[model samples]
Target: MARNPAPFAPFEWMIAWRYLRARRAEGGVSVMTWISLIGITLAVFALIATLSVRSGFRSEFVSTILGANAHVTVYDVGRVGQQGQLDRAIADYEGWAQRVAEVPGVTRVAPLIKGQVLISLRDSSSGAEVYGIARDDLKSLPGIAQSDQAAGDLTRLDEGIAIGSGIARAIGAGVGDTVKLTSPNGVKTAFGTSPRVNAYEVVYVFSAGRYDIDRTRVYMPFAEAQAFFNREGVADELEVMVEEPEAVNALTIDILRAAGDRAQVWTWRDSAGGFLRALEVEDNVMFIILSILVLIAAMNIVSGLIMLVKNKGRDIGILRTIGLSEGSIMRVFFICGAFTGLIGTAMGVVLGCLFAIYIDPLFSFVNYVMGGGVWDPSIRGIYRLPAELNLSDVLSAVGLSLGLSFFVTLFPARRAARMNPVEALRYE
Candidate 1:
């Protein structure tokens, strides 16, 4: 009759340690096994660290964009069809705007006019996207608006402007310096139209840490934008600053209910369109592609363990004949294979986290060597890469690495378990 194995003690560590020590000088553990263990360890660490860095880049990039742009945008649907009807649309828009402020989750609603415009500064001429924002609500935007200026006077008399650092650099405009703004006006009988020109002094310079926004964003009073475009008492869009960006979908539905057919509510994701879709696709693709490294490592574990099973067959047979059952023999091999995985995974988690934690400094050192790494004193921005580590990312990385390690040992352990003692002991 077979002896009953003690619960939780079937595969004890002391047995595993003795087996490992006895085989250290033997042919069971080959050079290939060591190489495979090292490979798996390195691959798992690299995947975890690489994915963390990528995640950091994605998150920082999104925050930079969201900082410059509002949570949601409300635009006149009719404005898409005709520029002439803008004057008549303001009354209906004003009524709806008031109600939007009263809606739950709605924090602030500000009128905005945006269009492409040409700007000429001295001899420098460049085309830029112009944003006409309400002077009173300017404090709501990031970078330019701050807690201190939330209630400050932001009155735009006529031609005051706030320009992004990139735009200012492109136009060579400084605070109190003037730049010419030009936009297409109504069509004429003989000619298409000429650009309506006006000069505005730069009132403020803002940086939102994104090249796209810092280079192209130009803020002006709504009245000034309407005048420049030859469309008085009209706004191109209504920008909404929500309490939370995640609430945009629900708030958008509620807004559409109020605006009905008059205006279209759009979230930041909608405004960015294909770009946002591409970002999401990129994240998923990168994750799956990077995970292949870990998979390759897991395969290495399997190869190493299979070799161990083959080399240990005779030893396993002798142990089974003496006292150890087939199940215990299997447990011995399982312990060996699992030990490799567990040790590698534990090492990888620590190494990967350390790499992530110091990635910013490492990038800084590289950038310093590149010579173009200097931050402009005037421009308040993060020239260095941003990395925000989340617990979820760490948990997923460690868990996946360990899980892969465990899975890799399963087949080899099963094979070791089912080995025929008679065939294994043929030489003995």
Candidate 2:
């Protein structure tokens, strides 16, 4: 007698064709198979697309933080409550700047004195955050390159200031306009203390795309800040630039130790803890909730295979009688179920990537349909929302969904394989 070929056979097409033929003979593809395919397809699409969107959102948040804040912030945390020595602060800044530059990944360092102050021009008055900066110190800040330049070297100006685009528009001020500023003295003026105030001309307006900053940031000279605020020598914060934003936490610790209590050190995350935590929580919750779509689709695979098992009971019984082993029978069902999942996931991955790639245009379309949309990058004062797609994110989503689909069908496939040959044959 001729030896039977391996139970699964050598040709994949043969096995697939057998399945197709069987499917057609049994009144064509069953409703269960159609449902299962669509379910898996939709699940895969939703999971992939949702993950891509979440990834986009997370990146947008990171970009916003980086644009609005420095990578590392250094400030006095001494018992003195604050430090106020321009010469001392500059000396310390130069020393720390050199040392920080020596550290691996250190890119650049910038000095700033940040404080809240009352700003008034003519009859219009508003509260704003005043950032006293040296032109050299803030030149590398994102979007600074786009600022309008004045006649003299920026750092050389003793009392010049830069306003955010929003602030300029709001106050109806422009270059050459003079404004008065007042800041609290850290003590009541009536207690033999006087708040500091000064007059300065608007030099340039910088738009950093952070709406809040664009609407409220005021940049002036370091000396001017001291004269206006009565704190001449000390800096409220030092902004350190880094090669990689992710290394900020480690660098903050190292910088703190180096500064030795002259100031508290902070990372972007520390400065924006509440927002970061909220974003993280939202990402996790969204990921978990969306995963249900894939899970539901996996369940459909199980149901479809169960229906196949019931319909093909006679075929399975005949094959077993002809010497096919239980393991081989199981492989057939597993292949069928896995194939369905594979096809759905592949399609979903393609569509998901397409969606991410064209997200901006799609949003624009929605905006156009709605009759109007936000265009100013400085609304709240800065640029528009940013988005990016990371390959790792896509790979992770597809890998997870495919793995889940396979695992979910394993037991069902085994159940069909383990059916007793005698019992299956006895049916009908």
Candidate 3:
């Protein structure tokens, strides 16, 4: 009696499934299969996790930097020198600020006096950037609205000043304490030029979520800042915030036209371009390096499938003799390799997403065990490790892995399909 031909199923699929599940003793599967699967899983995990962290870091950096600074700044073309220039500039500043505020997309316009001053509390002294801004403008500043992190009321800033957490710590000054500020631009005296010195009461302490700002920024009332710097009624620059900071470039012409020829415009991107560009370059390089890792893993699939074909020579011969076509034979091995890759890719995607989501806690746990700052945020200029899982990145990684797996299987699958049944059986 004639037995069922290849179990009465699509011989290609049936053979592929059987080969995948075959025991070591039956010569169906080998250690190489598991190695390839594990390799693919690891490669996918690393790629996804790294890319997510990179994206997170970029977002955190941008937000933190912009939180402390305006999206755009308008500066006077000439320096504010004597009383005449200072008075005229101050008179024109209000009009300029009002006109700029009326421009489309302009959310807020703040006239500010910024200058470097030496801050001293007893023996300890540190150089700090002093910003004189209106109390109302504080409400519009990003990261300044977090009342939990601010020690005192910004509205109460009159003769008092607010210092950053870093500045407070550096000079051992805090709320209710007094610190001295010395300006380099001093007044001329009969005895010669004397540096302008003044004492300020620290009434508030703010954490701007940025290392540089938190470490070196001090804020005072606009009028007080102008008076302290000996440039009463004059502002050095006008800081402008927009509805959408990323689109500020599009609004440059409108802003410039509003400010007229006396003021020069500087966008946030222009100020931080070098740093942002470096980060983008680094992200691209990392992707390329991680992709190479996946390629290496894919090469393992090639070797494993080749060995699978060699070890199953007798089985291939029997299937050929039983009327399985060369096309079916090739598909059997192709499915075998593709199936392994697909399973690995699925597992990797799941694992990578989970890893990215819990990366912060995982690092904390590791740091506890290791007794060190393994993932210190201060080292990277942010407050924590951020991870933002991107779907496109995940899909790209998966597609690359599977594509490499499929491509490598072609040569080995064709070799298995083209084997002479007589020769394969005679050898077996």
Candidate 4:
């Protein structure tokens, strides 16, 4: 019924393929084609690589926070004293810790007394935050209980003190070394309150992976902390771990109920030092900026195809004279642009995925070539760089590359379709 075989038919594909593969002397693809293809590949690769790294960084950051800190923390609102002044502490913290642990989804609990102290080893000194916990309760801590997190004798935690690796480095103190701790909370005597200064053996060293936490944290026995902080019988608060840290928000009501009246609850999402918010903001900014870059690269497709249309003017005139429709001419150029995009995107995806998947070994090689110090744990807040390849990000990149390539190709394509055969042949 019709002379044409329909749009983008086999004949159109054959002509498009011939146009793409023919030599430049035959008025085929120019140098611009290779340039546009390479640009698209490089841009897509950079976008995917950056996304994978951001994902890995977020994953490690959140993991460190959850491992080293409580999913939900329960404390007392404190009671008004006889003088109408408030004195705050979680009274009978052990009892409340047990009660909260009974709630479903709660995995572990520790009744702890927390205080700040100045730790010294000879002339070296550093400030440290101390947690008062029992030897048996050491295993209940999410981060410290891990084999990689703790070194030295965990058994002797009750007999002495456990200091963080950064504190040990700061004061040149090692396990089995004596370190002096001075607390401002002192015993009140008839004369005046005196600062509590005591020397204890550093029996173990631990790393929480978070720079702030590891640099200034230590653990003491519960009884010792109670006495050292001048609250002989009570603990500061109840630290709790749950089966699902993300679901901690839903379980806060049950925790408050279990902890009784005048109890307050907070989750790690709010309490994880404000750095998480900064990281999220950074992630959004990077994605927006990189997406713009991908767009710029896809624009190169317009430049390349425009040049191709000019070079193929004579061939286009001959085809139009032989009765080719304008739509067929446009479809032919459209296929050319799309094919370049497809091959380039494929190459970029493969390279980006491989880089993310084998990041560890690749990182090691980089660190070696740089002669170490590629990543600073103190500065970056993590010991290593990480990457996570997400399928959605890859899909988004592919869609963007192909979409821009096709859209920009239309202008040059329509020009070729509408060319006057007489003028095209007359010029040649």
Best by lDDT: 4
How displaced is residue 80 in candidate 1, in Å?
A: 10
For each candidate, what is the lDDT? 0.70, 0.70, 0.85, 0.86
Residue 129 shift from truth in candidate 1, angstroms = 2.1
Candidate 3 matches the true fold with a TM-score of: 0.92
C-alpha TM-score for every candidate: 0.83, 0.80, 0.92, 0.91
User: How many clashes does each candidate structure show, in the order listed?
Assistant: 0, 12, 0, 0
Q: Candidate 4's residue-wise lDDT over 1-428, tens digit each? A: 65876889998999988888878788766577787889889888888888899889988888888877878888889888897987678777877888898999998888888999999999999999999988887766656767385778888888899988889889998889999999887878998888999999999998877787789999999999999999787888888889988778899999999999879988998776487788879988987887788778778878888888988899899999998999999999998888888888888888889889999999999999999988899898877898988898889878877787778788888999999999999957
Task: Give me the overall lDDT of model 1.
Answer: 0.70
Winner on TM-score (2 vs 4):
4
Q: What tens-digit string does per-residue lDDT give for candidate 3 at 1-428?
A: 85434522476677798888888898856588888899989999888988888888888888876787889999877755666464224447898999999999998999998889999999999999999999889767867656357787776788588888888888898888989999987777798778899998998898888767888888888888887777676788899999999888999999989998887799999988999999989999999998899889878878888888989999889989987878788888998888888888888999999988898888788888999767654567777788889988898889888988888888889999999999889956
Query: In model 3, which runs have C-alpha deviations exceeding 4 angstroms?
Result: 1-11, 79-91, 375-379
Backbone clash total for model 2 is 12
lDDT tens digits by residue: candidate 2, 1-428: 97655656654335544663465556435566667777777776676667677666666667656765788877655442245533324336666666666677778777777779887899887788988777776666665534443222344345488877677777777777898877776444556766767788877766665667767888877777766665665566677878889767767767776665565777887767796688779877877887877888878888877777777777778878887777777777777778778877887777777777887787788778888556565342224433456787677767877898789778877887788778888845
Point out the worst 10-residue segment of candidate 3 by lDDT.
Answer: 82-91
Worst 10 residues of 1 by lDDT: 147-156
lDDT minimum window of 10 residues, candidate 4: 138-147
Better of 1 and 2 by TM-score: 1
- Each candidate's root-mean-square deviation in Å? 4.6, 4.8, 3.4, 2.5
